[model samples]
Target: MRKHWTIVTGLLVIGSVWLTACSDGKSGQSSVDSDKPAEQAKSYANEPAELVIYGAPGDPPEVWNERFGDQLQKKFPNYKFTYIQRSGTNTIENMIASGAQVDLIYDSVGNAVNSVVATGSQLDLSELVKKHNVDMSRFEPATVEAVKQFGGLYGFPVHSGGLVLYYNKAIFDKFGVGYPKDGMTWDEAIELGNKLTRNDNGTQYIGLGQSYIHVLSMNAYSLPFVDKATEKAAINSDKYKKIVDTLIMAPAKAIGYKEQIATLKRLFNNNDFMKERNIAMYVMNFGLQGQKDFESLDWDMAALPVFKDNPGMGTQPYPNFLFISNASKYKDQAMEVLKYVTSDETQLALSKKGYIPVLKNESIKNAFAQDSNVKNKNVVKAVFTNKFASPIARTKYDGKLNSPLQTNLIKAILGEIDLNTALRQTEEEVNKAIEAEKKK
Candidate 1:
C-alpha cells in the first residue's frame, strides 16, 4: 500500500539545525529509509504528490494562478500544486484549527507574518536556504533584511512594490505649474502642493492626496513601531515625529481646514487621481497596475519625494514573500518551487507584465511594465532611481500598533489634539498592548 505525508508534532530546532521528522503511517521515521540520511532522501519527490500552497487575506484563486500558479505548475509537473484561497470562513487560524496541512503561504510580508507566522507554525528557512545554496544577495537588501528583522530567514520575496508618485498631467497643466520632477524633496513637494491646491470654479482641487497612510507606513526614516529591547512604542522619537509633520499632516493642512478631514480621507482613494481628477500628485506602489482608468488619463510618474535630509532615498521596500511552513513534509519540494519563482527568467517575465520583480536586476527594471496596461509611462525612473530606505524591524506587535498610532495621529492631524499629546497617548496604548501580547 502507498503511504502519504502526515503532519509532524513537536518538530523542534536543536542547535543549528531543524530536527524534524514526519511519517507515512508505515514508517516510524520520515518516508525515506531511516538507515539513510534525511538530507540524502529525495524529499518524497520520487512519487506522485500534492503540495498545498495557501494564499490569504486578499487575491482570488484565478489571480493567484495568473501570477504564480501556472508558472509553478509548469516547473514542477510531478506534483499536484494546489492554491488554497483564504475566505471569510476559511481563515489561517481556522485552517490550522481544522488540521489541514499547508505547505507554503505567500502574501504581503506584513500580513503574512501577522496571520501565518504568528501561528507559531512558520519555518525559519535559514538551514534549508544554506543547504540549497540559494543566493540571498539577488534580492533587494532591505527586503531580505525585513524578513530577518524577525531574527531568522523566515521567508524570501517573490516580487516588490515600493513607493512612486503618480501625478495627473491635466491638473498640473491647468495650474500652469511645471510637474513635480524626479529627486524632488519633501519640502519641494510641499511647495508644489501649495501651488496646485485651490477651489478653481468650486472643484476643490487638493494637490497632495498622496496615499497618506502609505507615506507614513513606508516612511524613508525606517522608523519602527516598538523598540525590540525596550518593548516600548518607538513612534514618539524625533524621526517618527518628523515623518508625521512632513508627510502626513502637511498635505491635508495645505488644502485648508474646511476640507482637511475630507481631503485626508481621499488620500487612499485612487479615484482622486483618475475619476474626479482633483488630486494633482498621488504617490502609490505597484498596486497601480490594477487601476483600469489610469491608462485613459493624462498621467505620468515621478520618484516618491524624499526628505531633504535624506536626499536620493525612497520609501522602504514592500515585498510579497513566499514562505515555507514548518508542518510541511515536502520541504525540499517547496524550496525548489520557491527557487523557480525568484529565478532571473521568472522575475524578468513578471516584471515586463508590470509585476515588479524582487530581484535586483537593472535589465528587469528597464523592461518593467513593457507589456503592462500602463506601459507608456517612465516606470523605471518612477521606481528605480533611488535606493530604498532601510526598513525597520517589524515586531510581532506591528499589527497591534497600527490602531493607536493612526487614531491618535489622525486626531492630531485634524487639530483636535496637539502632536505631543498624540505621541504620548500612542506610546501608552502600545506599551499596554505589548504587555498584553506578552501574556499570550
Candidate 2:
C-alpha cells in the first residue's frame, strides 16, 4: 500500500480551487513518496533518461509542445517526456503515487501554489539558479520578484497576458469624437467615455467599456487584495478607494442613480465592444485580438491608460511561471531546461504568436504580434508604448475580496452609501471571510 501526504493548509487549496487556472480548469493533484513497481520506479526525475513535463492546455501533448516539441526532440531524442494533462483521474498526484516522474511544472502563480505548494512537492531552485549562472536581470524585474512572492524562488516566468486599450475607429468617426491617444489618464479617458455614452436614435451607444472583473486584479498601482504578513484584509486604504471610484466613473460620465449597476455590467463585457457594436473604446487583454469577433470591427489598439502621477505606465505584469518540483533529483538538468525555456530563441517564437514574452529586451518586446493575424504594424507597437507596472503579490483571499468591494462601490455610486461607509462595510465582510477560511 502507498502512503499519501496531505497538503499543510486547506486555505491554499480553497483559494486555488476558487481561482481559475492559467489556461485550463483547476487541478487539485496530490504528491507521492512511496514505493512502486520496478518499471514505474524508473520514471523519477533522477533517472534523466526518462522525464515528465506538464504542458499548457491544448492538443494531445499540451499545445505548448505543438510549437517546441520538435525542437526539443531534435536536440535530445532519448529524453522521454510525459506531458501530463488534466484528464479525469490521470492527475499529477496519481502519477507521483504510481512512481512516475515529478519535475517541471509550467503554470501561473495562482495555480503554482495550488498545484505544488499546497501538495508539499515544491523544490526551491535558488542554489541551482546560482550554480547555473542564470541571469535574473534579463527578465522583467516584476516577473522575477513575483516567482519569489510566495516564499522561495520556485521558478522563472516565461510568458504573460498583457493589457491594452482597444477602440472602434468607425464609432469614433461617427460620434465626431477624437480618437483616443496612447497616454490618456483615467480622468481623460472618462471624459472621452462621456462623449460617446448617449442614446443616439435608440441605439444607446456606450462610449467606453472595460473588463471590470479584471481592473482590480491587474491594477496599475500594484495594490494588494490582502496583506500576507498580518493575514488580514488590506483593501480599506485610500489607494483602493481611488481604484473603486475610478472604475465606477470610467464607463459612464454620470450613470443614472437607478441604472448604474446594470449599465456597468453591460459595458464591462468584451462582447459589448466587439460583437454588440456599441462601445467606442475598451480596456482589455491584448490576446483578444485573435477572437473572431475582431474580424468584423474597424478597430485598433492603444497603450493602456496611465495615472496622472505616473505619466506612462502599463498594467501590472500577469505572468506564467515555469516551476521545478523538489521531487526531482536532477536539479542541474532541470536548471539547464529552465535556461532553454527562457532563451531568446524560445521567447521570440512565442512572442510572434502573441504569447507576451517575459524578457525585458526591447527587440523581443517590439516583436510582439508581428506574426499574429493582426495586419497592422503600428497597432502592434502600441502594446509596449508604456512601461509595465510591477506585479502585486497575490494572497489567498484575492477572489473573496473582489465581490465585497464591487458591491459596496456600486452602492456608493448609487448614493446608497458614501465612500467611507462603502470601504468600512467592505473591510468587515473581508474579515469575516478570512476568519471563516482560518477555521477550515
Candidate 3:
C-alpha cells in the first residue's frame, strides 16, 4: 500500500503563477531519503518514466506542493514530474494550440475541455482508467456522467464544486429572521432577504448580495456558458426568462431597492455586506476563498435555494477534470501520476487544503466535516447527494451571447425594456451566433 501523508496549512495566495524551466527527467537532480527501503526502491525502479503536467494556477496547490509533489518525486525518482501553472483559460488554450505535449492538463469541465477536444489535443482516457484500476464507483454518478463524451472518457475527476448560499448569521439573528433551511425555496430566500435589508446612513442594501450574470444564467436555466455540440448559443430558454425575472427583475422593481446589476461591484468595493452587517445572503462556490475578511463577523452557509416545484435539486455541479494530451511523449507515466493524484488518498489530502475531494472515501468526508472554517457542511453534502438533474447542454456561442443577453435582461428588470421584447431580442442575437458557429 502507498503511504498516506497529511498536508499542513500555510498562507494561501489566492492566485499565483507557476512556471517550470525545461529539463530532462534525470540530471540536475536532488535526491531525498526515500520512504521506501533500498530493496523496495530497487523493486519500484521498474515503474514507467517521467511525466509533465500543466495546470491552472489557484488554491490548494500553494499548500499541497511540498507534500504531494515532493513525495511523488522521491518515491518514483525515475518518473520526473514537472508542473507548470498558467494564469488563465486563454493562456492554457494557447499552449494547447501550440502543441505543447503535456502529459496531463488540469482544466474546468465544460468549456475548457470542449475547447481542447475541438482542437484535437486530448487523448481518450477510457483505456487508461481501466488499465490503472481507477475506482469510478467512488465518485458521484452525475459527476462521472459529466465527463463522458462521444462514448469515450476524455478525462477523470479531479475536484468537485457547486454553488452554495453564504449568509451573515449575525444579520439573520438581528432581524429576528429564521435561518435558511436545507430545502428552502428560492421565493422563500428572496422574501427573507428583503426582510433583512435596510437603508443604513442613506446607503441601501437589499436582502441578498448580487451574483455574476453568468452564474445567474446557470442556476436559473441550467444553461452552460458555452455549448459543446452545435458550438452555438443555448441561452434562450423559458427557464432563463424566469431566472431573469426573479433574481434580476423582481428585485429591481421592489420599492427603494437598489438594482441587482450593481450588486457585485458594490459588494467588492464598498464592503456592502461587511459594513452594514445586514446582508442576509449571497451565492458563491464551495472553496470560500477571500472569506477570511469576513472572519470578524458571525456567518454560516446554506444550499443555493431550489425552485419551489424543483424541490431536492438546487444548483449544477461544476467539477474540474484532469486529461492527458494526445501528443504527450510520456503518456503512460503521466497516467500513473494522474491515477495517484486523483486516488482517494490524494483527493483527501488535497481537500484538507480547500479543494473539494471527488472521492467518497471516509477520510475525506471526515476531514470536510471537521473543517472549522466550513460553516455549512450539510449544504455541501446536500449538493453532492441530492438527486439533482444534469445541466442543459451549452453551445459554443453561449459565452459570447451571455453578455448581451444579460445586458438586455438587466434593462428589462430596470423597466427600460419590456420583458417580452427584451427576451425576443436576446433570442434573435443568440440564434445569430449559433448560426454563425454552425457555418464555421
Give the least accurate 10-residue stretch of model 1, judged by summed lDDT.
Answer: 21-30
Give per-model CA RMSD. Answer: 7.8, 9.7, 8.0
Better-scoring candidate (TM-score), 2 or 3? 2
Clashes of 1: 0
Candidate 1's residue-wise lDDT over 79-193, tens digit each? 6655566665666676676667777777786676676667866788877766555667778888888777766777778888888988889989997999888989888888898
Model 2: per-residue Cα lDDT over 1-440, one tens digit each: 11111111222232222111111000110112236521211111222343445542322553556445544444344355445554555555555555555666767755566566766667778776554555577888878877787787888887876678889999889978888888778888878888877767767676767776567667788777778788777778888878867865545444432263456543257877778887788888777776788887898887888888777777876678777777775655555556666777778777877778888888887787678777473455567777777777776676787678778766766667887788889889999998998899
Alpha-carbon lDDT of model 1: 0.71
Best-performing candidate as measured by lDDT: 1
Residue runs of model 1 more than 4 Å from their true location after superposition: 1-47, 255-258, 262-268, 293-295, 401-403, 433-440
Model 2 TM-score on a 0 to 1 scale: 0.81
Residue 338 lDDT in model 1?
Answer: 73
Score each candidate by Cα lDDT: 0.71, 0.66, 0.57
Error of 1 at 406 (Å): 3.9
Q: Give the residue spans of candidate 3 off by over 4 A.
A: 1-48, 57-71, 88-90, 96-99, 149-151, 224-228, 258-278, 290-292, 361-363, 369-372, 375-385, 433-440
lDDT of 2 at 87: 50
Q: Clashing residue pairs in candidate 3, if any?
A: 193-207, 227-394, 227-395, 227-396, 232-396
For model 2, name the residue pairs that clash.
123-326
lDDT of 2: 0.66
Per TM-score, the best of the predicted structures is 1
lDDT per residue for candidate 3 within 1-440, as digits (tens), equals 44222221211221222221111211111122246522211122335454555554332545335435664665465554555555444345565545454556666654654445655756787675554445567776656666663235767767777777777777677668888766677788777777766765765656766555535644734655445565545445676667766766655555545443445422222255555554567676665534556768676677677776677776666677767677676555555555666666667666765566766675785566344455344544544444545645543455666556666765665567787778778767777766776688
